[model samples]
Target: MGIITAGKYEGQHPIHPKARQILLDAFDQGWADPTQISSQGRQAQALLDQARESIAKSLGLKVDEIELWGEPELISPIAIWGAPGFGVSPFIYGATERSEIIGMRGKSKQFFEISVDIDGAIDLELLTQTLQPNSIVAIQSANIETGVIQNIKAIAKAVVAQNAHLHIDATASGARFVKPSYWSTLHFDARSWNGPSGVGVFALKNGARWSNPLPHTRPTRAPNSFSIPLALAAASALEHWIADEAANSTRLKSLIERVRNHVKQTISDVDIAGNAESTLPNIISLSFLNVSSEQLVAELEIEGFSVASGSACVASALEPSHVLKAMGLLTHGNMRINLNHDVQDGEITKLLALLPGIISKLREN
Candidate 1:
C-alpha cells in the first residue's frame, strides 16, 4: 500500500536531491569543530560560514544578524523575554499561536492573548489596542495547524510604534512565504523546508534590543553549535525552495482547493478551517461531526494514509487543539493535511475520493 498523507507533522518534506548529496559530501568536514584553529577545523569553519551567509541571503538578512542554533526552542525564550534594558515586559501573542509561544505565558512579567477571527487570523485591531510600550509581542508568520498566514508586516509596524519588540515564529512559513523585512526577530526550523532536522536559525535584526536569557559565563551570543553538514543542507534546501516557490505554490494551491471543495461537497456536517485566500497553499484543516480524530487517523493509516489532528507539533498529546478551540471551531473529528513539494496529483485525488466514504463509515461506527 502506498502512503498518502496530506497533512504532515512539523512541515516535514523529503530532502531535495541536491541537499542530500551536499549533506553526504560534507560528512567528513562537518565532523570537525569550527571553533578550533587547526587546518581541518578551518575548512569546517569555512563551510559553516558559507552556510550561514547563504541562509542569511535567502532571508534578506546580513550574516551577522543570524545565528545557527540547535532548535527553535533553544532560541525562542531568549528572543522573547530578554530585552536589553528591560528586565521583563508584558508578553502578547495571538490566541491561535502555537504551543511554544503559549508556553511563554508565565515566563514574562505579564501575559495577554489577542483574539483571533473565526478564520484563525489574529485581530489586528485588538492587537493595536493591546500593545504597550516596552512590551514583547510574539507572532507567527503562519499557523501550523490552520495554515492561516498573519500580516506580520502590519503587526510589526504596530509593535514598533509602541516601542515594543516583535518575535516572529516563521517556522511554518520558511519556504512557503518570504520573510517580512520589518521583523525585529525571526525564528525558523530547517525541517520546515525539506532540510534536515535538529537545526534551527535564529535571527535578530541589528539594533534590536535583546540580551541573553540563558545563564552563562561566556559572552558569546549563540549558546550552542549545530552540525555543519546539517546547516549546509538546510541552506541548500531553503535556496531550492525559494527558487521553486512560485511554481510550487500555484500547483499546491490547485491541489489543496480540489481536496477542500471535494470534501465540502461530499461530506456532511463538516467544517473547513482557515482562510484559503490568505493561508499556506499546501495545508488544509477539516472537521467532521461525531467523529473521533484519533480513530479516524488510525483508520486512515490502516488504509495506508497518514494524517494528523490537533497541533502537529504536539500531536502526541490527547487534549483538544487549542488552535481550533481558540478559533471558536470544533476540535473533534479534525484532520490536517500538509502537502510537500513532491506530493503528486494522483495522491491528492486518491485522498479526496477516499475521505467522504471514510467519514461516513466512521460516523456510522
Candidate 2:
C-alpha cells in the first residue's frame, strides 16, 4: 500500500497531509537562492534556517556542524577524500550499510575493508588486531540489510586507542536504535546520518576537518541547497517517529517474537536470521528450507502481503543479499519482514497464519 518501501514514513502511500502542507509552504517561501540578500533570497534564507534548525535538533547537534546534503551517500567518500594524506590504510566495514557506498569506493586515494561477523557486525577482535598507525576507520553504526546493530561505542573506543579518525555511517541507524549524542561522546571526527533518507545530515564535530566531494568555489559549494525542504520534512518525521519509539518497539518486538515462535512451531526447518536480541525491532529475516526467497516473496505478494526477501533496495538483483552472505546464513528463501509505524499485531498474526501453508506448498515444488 506504500509508495516508498523504507524508512519511518513507510506504508503511508500518499504523503502525510500535514507533512505535505509543510513542504508546500516551505517551497512557496523558498523560491530563490538563499545565498542572495534580495527579498526572495531572504525568504529562502529563512526557510533554510528553519530546515537546518529542525535537522540539527533531530540529530542532537548545532545547526552549523550539520552539513545538509540531498544525497546521503556523498558523506564518507567526501570525508575520506578530504583527509590530509594520512598515508595510513583506511579501514572500511567489510560491507557497506547503504547501496550507494558500493559506487563510492575506489574514488578515494587509499582504503581497506575489515570483515564482519556472521551477524553482519564487524568483528571487534579483528578490528583491534588490525589497528595500526595512521588508520582511518569507517564503521556503519547499524547494518541496513541484516538489521545487525554494531557496538559503535566499543568500536569507537578501539578506534580512538589506535589514534585513528573514525567516520560513522549512521545511514539506517534508527534513532531508537542508536543515539547521536552517544557518537558525539565517542568523539567521531565526522559522521553521516541519513536523516531518514532524502535528508542527509553530515555532522562534522567541532575542529574536525573533512573534504567535500563536490568542488565549487569556497563561497558556493552546496550540492543541493533546496534540499532544505526535504530535510525539514524528514526532521519532522524523525521527531514524531523517535518520540513513540519505545512503545512502538515493544509492540513490534512482541509481534515479531510471536511470528518467530509460530514459524518455529509450525515449520520444521525454517531459519530465523539476524541477531535475535541486538537487531532492530522492526526487521525480521527468516528463510524457509528448500525454497527460493524470490518464490516466497512472489507468493506473499499474491496473498496481499508486501515484504522483502532481503534488502528491499536490491531485491531484484539475481544474487542473494550481501548481508545474508556476510552473516554466513542460507541466502535462499530469505524473507525480510519490515514492520512499519502503523503495522499492528493483528497484521503479524494474519501473516503468520498464511506463512506455514505457503511454505508447505512452495516446498512441494
Candidate 3:
C-alpha cells in the first residue's frame, strides 16, 4: 500500500505508469551521450531537447532557461545560495520556509525572518518593511506538511517596489501555485506531478543577475546532470497529469473540505493547522490534543489506513516541525494526509468514519 495509499507525501511517488513506459523507451533511444557528435548522440540530444521543451511549456518558461538538476534537495542551494547577489543582499524570508532554504541563513550578509501567523501566512508588513533594493527573498508557495499557501502576489508587489529578487520554492505546489512573472528563480519538483524523482527543474528568468556558484572553468558554465530518460519520464508525467488529474482536482478539493468539516464537527480539541481557503488541495494537517501522534499513526496503520505524523521523528527524537512551530500550532499529536490521484472518495469517507474512534481510543490510554 505504499504508493497505493492516500499517505503519499512521505516518499517518491511511484512514477506514473505511462511515464514508466516512456522512461523505458527513452533508455532504448536516449542512452548515448547527447554531447557527442555521432548520429546516435544527435538523436539522444533531440529527445532531451523535446523533454525540456515539454516541461518548459508546462511551466510557462523558455526552453533555454530550464536546467535538469539531479536532485530536488540540491536544487534549492543551487538556485538560491548559488547566486552571487545573495551574498551581499538583505535576506528576507518567512520562518516556515523549508529547511534547505533556511539552512543557508548563516552565509547571508544581512537576514530577517518574519514570523508566520497561526494560519502560516508570512507577515506582510514586516516583510515589506525589510525589503531593500538588493534584497534576496526565499518563500515557498505552500508548506509541504501543512499545505499552507503564501500570498505570492502581494509579496511579489513589495519585492518589485524595492527592486529585489524573489526565489519562489514551488516544490510543494508546482506551477499550480506559482506566478512566473514574480520570480527571479523558480523551482518545481517533477515528483509533485508523479514524475521521476531526482528530476528537479529550476528556471532562471532572462537577465537575472546570477551565476553558477559551483566552481567552473568558465564564468558562464551551467550544470545539467540528470538522466535523459528520467527527464523524458518527468515530461510524460506532467502531460499525463495535466490531461488526467487536473480535472479531478476540483472533486478532490471538495472531498478534502468535507474531511476538514467532518473532523472539526465530530472531534474536539483538534487543531486544523492550515487556512482552509488557501491551502493546497492534496494535503491536510490535523493535531489532536491529548493523543500521541505515534499512537495515532500506528493505530491507523493497523486499521488498513496509512497516514503520517507531522514532525515525524528523526534519530529517535521527535523533531519539531518548523512550519507548525513558527505558526504557533501544536507540534505533537499531529497527522498529515496527502491524497493521490488513485485515492477514491470512498476511501476518504472510510477514513473519516474511522478517525474519531481511533483518536478517542488513543486519547483514553
Best by TM-score: 3
Model 1, 57-87: lDDT tens digits are 8877899999988765666766776654333
TM-score of each: 0.93, 0.85, 0.95
lDDT, candidate 3, 208-307, per-residue tens:
8777888878664256677888888889898887775667888878877988999999999988978789899878889888888888877788777777
Local distance difference test, each candidate = 0.79, 0.61, 0.80
The Cα error of candidate 1 at residue 122, in Å, is 1.0
lDDT of 2 by residue, 276-328 (tens): 77776666778777887677877777777876666333366766676777677
Please rank every candidate by lDDT, starting with the best.
3, 1, 2
lDDT of 1 at 134: 69
Model 2, residue 85: distance off in Å is 2.9
- TM-score-superior candidate, 1 or 2: 1
lDDT of 1: 0.79
Candidate 3, which segments miss by more than 4 Å at Cα? 1-11, 28-30, 219-221, 312-317
TM-score of 2: 0.85
